[model samples]
Target: MSEKILNLYLVIDNGIIEEFRACSYEVAGSDEEKISFLKKNAANDFLSSFKFDPPVSNSGKKMKYKQFSRLEKQGKQFLLFEEIFQKFQVPDSPLICLTPVVDGEILSSN
Candidate 1:
């Protein structure tokens, strides 16, 4: 039997999607490892397709890399939620609020 794997879908606001399928054994119960894997493998394509405005803090300033890393972790959480919602026929919501420009067309998930 083929082993079941977890699929991680990264969707840009422009409706571009990049999917990463990883074996459950690869993560080995480490969220950090999973995030690292996704970032290393998929971040370039995902980021290239969409403009990422750096997240801001309550102080209204751009957050640092550490904060961005935290956001990456949060993204993984949202990915799981989206996966579940998709399976149950629930409308999937945008995990991040951003306007994606694709092929001279502006797309917004809102």
Candidate 2:
């Protein structure tokens, strides 16, 4: 059986997307989680210069390592709302993020 996974994908146009993924899969689902996941990953050089819209939240409740996931890749092709031209940017501001909350399976050891 395939395991459910939450994939956080960031794209950079370099002809080849030099693989820069989680240093540790222990990352959780809360914003309280350090986004430095990027800053600390190998893509830091290309990502360091751009500014993201809507100040991110590094506050409130926190989850333990490997406790939460959000890409919603539950063996499906689509999940929510209006058509978009991009896979990364929101169609508009996520001021309320009416989008669904996609909590995937917890990290498990078999």
Candidate 3:
């Protein structure tokens, strides 16, 4: 058998969503404070579409590269959370919060 992770992540700038690629995000996790932060900036539907589709570990993480490629119709490397975080980390920027992410799903099999 094989293991497929259904988890996904997002890049939250302050509270605003970077993009509404819900089809590009598959939800499940993110911090409550961050979620609350996002609530202040984004619409509720945007949050729900989290049933959209997208990140980083060998842990319970997912891949934005594949979904992003599929959604944006392009083949490029998925930006790591660290790189994305740096852009929004000017001290003036509130915070760059990510749900949680891995490079891809399907970690391993037996």
lDDT to native, each model: 0.36, 0.26, 0.33
Model 2 segments more than 4 A misplaced: 1-27, 42-85, 89-110
Error of 3 at 16 (Å): 22
Worst 10 residues of 3 by lDDT: 101-110
| Better candidate by lDDT, 1 or 2 | 1
Please count the clashing residue pairs in each candidate, in the order shown: 0, 0, 16
Tens-place lDDT digits, model 2, residues 62-103: 322122123234522123212221333433432111111123
User: Between the candidate structures 1 and 3, which one is better when assessed by TM-score?
Assistant: 1
Deviation in angstroms for 52 in model 3? Answer: 17
Residue 93 C-alpha lDDT in model 2: 32
The 10 consecutive residues of candidate 1 with the worst lDDT sum are 17-26
Q: Which segments of candidate 1 are over 4 A away from where they belong?
A: 1-48, 70-110
Q: Tell how far residue 45 is off in model 1, in angstroms.
A: 3.0
The segments of candidate 3 whose C-alpha lies over 4 angstroms from its true place after superposition are 1-35, 44-79, 90-110
Clashing pairs in 1: none
